[model samples]
Target: MPDAKQMVECPVAAMLELIGGKWKPVILYFLGSGTRRFGEIAVRIPTISRKVLTQQLKELEHDKLIMRKQYKEIPPRVEYSLTDLGESLSPVLAEMSIWGKKNVLEKR
Candidate 1:
């Protein structure tokens, strides 16, 4: 974790420190759709390497943005879904999507 002094310097930076990355937002976007297994997510977001995906998922779990459920069976099964906190971010993402369509895509 970054020090308090760094967080105090820029709050938005601190927030991004948790979520900002090449793959984190993409992971969040998929999880927003519904619960998914790690393999499912990996296949959907093919650009993300397995190692980076694992790291991103771990970070999201640590931040309480996503919940991980593990099932015991002959082969272990695990699923991930957004927590309540993560669901709260959905509106923000939606709004960004809307804005992007209007400003970015429309411009193009």
Candidate 2:
């Protein structure tokens, strides 16, 4: 791990810097389902531009939160899956999902 100073001044701040983006959590959520290809993820997340999606994936890979696999094939094959570190986030995300369903959905 990087030094505390190198990390965004504080642990929490650094954490947010890593996962607190417009699309990262959502990407993590879908990846929680299982491995998926770029196009598959793109189809599921329709609103994100391809450029943004690529950028987010690269960042996640750099953070060691996700793994990208490339395979040789007729065309080309790539898949993304959450790493163990990323899987550790599952419980938190699940709780948040429950909360959203309860507080946000119940009001509607």
Cα lDDT, all candidates:
0.89, 0.92
Give one clash count per candidate, in the order shown.
Answer: 0, 0
Task: Write the residue-wise lDDT of candidate 1 on 10-103 in tens digits.
Answer: 8777667777888887788789999999999999999889999999999999999999999988699999999999888788777767898899
lDDT of 2 by residue, 4-79 (tens): 5767588778777889988998999899999999999999999999999999999999999999999999799999
- Runs of candidate 1 exceeding 4 Å displacement: 1-11, 104-108
Candidate 2 global lDDT: 0.92
The residue-level lDDT of candidate 2 at 4 comes to 58
Q: All candidates: CA RMSD in angstroms? A: 4.1, 4.4
TM-score of 2: 0.85
Best by TM-score: 2
